[model samples]
Target: MSDKITSIVGARPRGHGEAVARILSLAAAPTFAIMALIAAAAPADMLCAAMQGPLSLQGMVPMYALMSAFHLAPWLRLVR
Candidate 1:
C-alpha cells in the first residue's frame, strides 16, 4: 500500500503501551541489570516486606505469577 493511501485512511497506529513496550525493549537489558543489582543489594527480608504496606496481596501475587509465566514460557515445557 502507498503512503498516500495510508495517510488518507488514517492508518490505525500503535497504542501508548505498545510504544512504551518498544522503548522498554530497547533498554531491557540495562533495566534488568539495575533491578538485579538492587534486589541483590537489598536485605532479603526487606525485599518481601517492602511491598506489603503499599501493595495488595490479592493483586500482586497473581500479576507477578502471570508475568513470570509469560517471561519463562520460552524455556518451559508442558508434558500435558
Candidate 2:
C-alpha cells in the first residue's frame, strides 16, 4: 500500500523508468485477505501518536480507511 503511493508520487510517466516503476509498485500490493484485516484494525490513533500530530486523527481515520480500500482494491484487480 505504502509502496504503491510512494512509487506513484516518485515516478515520472514521461521517463523511460515508467514501466519499471509501475511494475514494481503493482507487485507490492497486499493480498485481499490481508488488506481486509488491516482495514479492520484502523490504527489511526497509533499513527497520530507516532506523528505527534498537529492534525486531527478523527478527521484522518476516514481518509485512512479510504486509502486502505484504495490499496486493497488493486490486488483484487478491481481498481488501480
Clash totals in order: 0, 0
Best by TM-score: 1
Q: Judging by lDDT against the true structure, name the best candidate.
A: 2
Model 1 worst lDDT run, 10 consecutive residues: 71-80
In the range 1-80, model 2's lDDT, one tens digit per residue, is: 55665465454356446656555545554443355456446665675567654444445444555555666543555254
Q: Per-residue CA lDDT of candidate 1, range 6-62, in tens?
A: 443343335555444444443444444455556545654656666555444443444
lDDT of 2 at 16: 45
State in Å the error of residue 13, model 2. Answer: 15
